[model samples]
Target: MLHKGEAINIAPNVVHWHGASHDSRFTHIAINPNVSQGGAVIWGQPVTDDEYNASRS
Candidate 1:
């Protein structure tokens, strides 16, 4: 589980997702540089609570 004041770094072009645990709050800042060089952000399907909880297991 992640604790407060912790952060994760995702490299460019990596397929990943993240969020806060239940009964908690999550906040983040995203930095996308070099967008004009064909960089893009593609969103996938939403993660259900079942999926999130399963990962915690």
Candidate 2:
């Protein structure tokens, strides 16, 4: 997860994801430029149940 003042730049044709610890919190801000004619930030698919379960530490 992103911390305070942290940022992620998802470039074109790029697929990325992040998450927090199972017992912690996760938070982030996504910005798209295409959506505003600059570029697009598309949130593709949701994390599958198996993916989340695998991420637990």
Top candidate on lDDT is 1
Q: After superposing candidate 1, which stretches have Cα over 4 Å from the reference?
A: 1-3, 49-57
lDDT of 1 at 29: 75
Clashes of each: 0, 3
- lDDT tens readout by residue for model 2, 1-57: 356777777668787777764566777666664676756665668877777777574
What C-alpha lDDT, on a 0 to 100 scale, does residue 22 get in candidate 1?
66
Which candidate number maximizes TM-score?
1
Please give the range of 10 consecutive residues that has the lowest summed lDDT in model 1: 17-26
**Each candidate: RMSD:** 3.1, 3.0
User: Candidate 1: deviation at residue 8, Å?
Assistant: 2.7
lDDT of 1 by residue, 1-57 (tens): 678887787888799877676656678677778679877678789988897677467
**Superposition TM-score, candidate 2 onto the true structure:** 0.54
